[model samples]
Target: MSLGDEHDGASAGGGGTGQTRTRLPDSGAGDVYGVYGGARRPARNSRSLITVVGVVVLLIAAIAFANRSGDGDGDGSSSDAPAGRAAAPTAATGVKPVAGKNGTIPSGYAHDEQGAQSAAANYAVALGSDGMFRQDSRHAIVRAVHDPAVVDGLLGRLDTAYSGAFLKNVGLNEDGSAPDGLTFVSRTVPVGTKVTEQTGDAATVEVWCTGLVGLAGEGSTKPVTETWFTLTQKLKWTGNDWKIESSSQKEGPTPVNGDNRASTADEIAGAVAGYGGFTYAR
Candidate 1:
């Protein structure tokens, strides 16, 4: 899709304030993709029903499983009481981490819809970052952000995408390295999040985001371009924590931007490396 399409309702901003003047085409309520503000109808494929059923089954299973795990009361005794009663306090008690403990990453996300939003936002930031462009850092970033079940698959594809030849195509050095005196930048800033559906133990959150990606060097071919995307995450409360189960992303609800002076390569690089990333709380 075109970067500035109005139908998708995506907007671009000069800075991180998230102000946008454009309006998106309206689709009536209850439309799936309409959540993003587009009129385009979803495909009338046979898989739609199957997909819905599968999601329902999964949700049911997750809720049941989470409920069956009795609350910790020192002595392990099972309770058949309403699952909601037990799950509520556990999910509610955890405080969202305000600052990163050891580094830039935020910690202490509460195990609820808010925590799911936090994870989705931060995960989006990690996924769209420059770290995904290098080999070792790419693996670290993916492992840190993705759900365990899909980590292997995601890592394999990421490895291929950031392979030596691919970096060359993107004007990087043969070893998937950046040229001297240049810094490549990639970062995603989350705009907002909405909990589409939520239960005591599970939640689905949509994180709208804007991303900057490109090389920053003198005479660079693609000097810092911008794009928008929304990340949808399914989160489950596991091991007394909230963890992402799976996530999918799509192109923007973007708007146009006013002209602004671009920062120098060294400046952008220094900011990225120097400034720490936040651990988000919804």
Candidate 2:
């Protein structure tokens, strides 16, 4: 996520972060694709709607192309050529998954396409977590997942991005905590991952995720809400592992919302407390 000056602004500012309007999904609808943080300007105009549709179409096409199976290639290696089409992005590369961690972030990712994809997914979860709002946790996460060259700059920018005012806007105290008798909920669950581009030394991967942000409690104005976005990370092999070189986010390849009742704040809090985050792998 690009870090913007404004709290609602995802990571960075400018043309890519999206608009500044808020629209609650119809609880009756199916999976809601939401852009978390900042104000997202709703696409009321025809041109804006068209642009969103175009983006959705392109993203879907890219994902489909990435996931397509090889054409009777005996070996399912990702490096294998698939005739006229693009290489299958998520095809297994027969590499071992990393089995280690540096602090909370997974370490030792395989130095291949699968490893890159895996690194992207796990990093997505960390970057989107509530921990990112806390100074210590944010530093650990940045050090764990980001390339050494950019870590210092990223930490400085992020520290400013999640400043006191921003935290207040999102219903947290100055130190990224709920006042009392409330639970702060900011989590990202990656549904799946794709390697949009790859090489021996670098890769660009997209992680489709559903996230929970906001607070949960009695009379909480910023009630926990879910968001949908595809986080694209440009990763490089560094110190024998995949580390984030750069990252950006965009609103969804979101599916149509389904008919499901929205959970109450208490129920949401309970469920969150009962669950644990996963260590994702390709």
Candidate 3:
């Protein structure tokens, strides 16, 4: 079947939809606080501060306990290990591919939950990268990550989604061009991943992601907005590899960050142009 046909099937049976869903605002480029006026900073209170501190301590302790508990089933392979212990490379040593392969695609995933997490994380990075700004590159990315059955339909819809108007709304000029002397960047960095459910051949992986999306140009209206999103992929082990059967994204499990210095356009542009993406592995 074509990509759109597959999307229809997945949507029909509610197969693609999962427990976690992304709540994206309809106005993709507008600020959520704009409708309600600018966001008001909450006033500080000593009592409130103390309560927050206490909660933080409890959270930390809970995290520590979860890590120590190793709640997930531990097979000989490291992929099924719990998130707490499976997070670090050392703990996840057995699951890491012998070496990165498939050009930029990480290979040798351990055919387990950890492997699904690794795939989901890397896929999120690929899906949200600046490469999606260009039509040709975007097609390549979707084909590479999506199951073969859905490639054509996804390509068509994505072509519409990344049309001239959408590009302009994303602060790009017509034909996906950036304003002179500026760069447009969109990338998702995975904060963590969890296997909500998994069987041998089918698995559901949710990647909690922090993304930066906007144009890095002087006088730009949207200057590098940050967002948190969770991407859940229903994966199938096909042809000796884990391929995305279907996936969806939703708003966040977000935490506010303290104020920090913003970088210059030059810095952001240089970093993006100079650096390259890694071949992620389990």
lDDT of 1 at 48: 67
How much lDDT does each candidate structure score?
0.51, 0.62, 0.57
Q: Give one clash count per candidate, in the order shown.
A: 10, 20, 7
Candidates sorted by TM-score, descending order? 2, 3, 1
Error of 2 at 279 (Å): 2.7
Instruction: Write model 1 residue lDDT over 184-251, tens digit each, in one string.
Output: 66567788776676777777667788766556767776455566677676666665555556555556
Score candidate 1 by TM-score against the native: 0.59
Best lDDT among the predictions, by candidate number: 2
Per-residue lDDT value at 278 in model 1: 46
Please give, for residues 142-212, the per-residue lDDT of candidate 2 as tens digits. 78887788776656656665567656666678897787988877677777776767767888777887777
Model 1: C-alpha RMSD to truth? 16.3
Count of clashes in candidate 2:
20
Poorest 10 consecutive residues by lDDT, candidate 2: 13-22
Identify the runs in model 2 with alpha carbons over 4 angstroms from their true place.
Answer: 1-35, 38-96
Determine which window of 10 residues in candidate 3 has minimal summed lDDT. Answer: 31-40
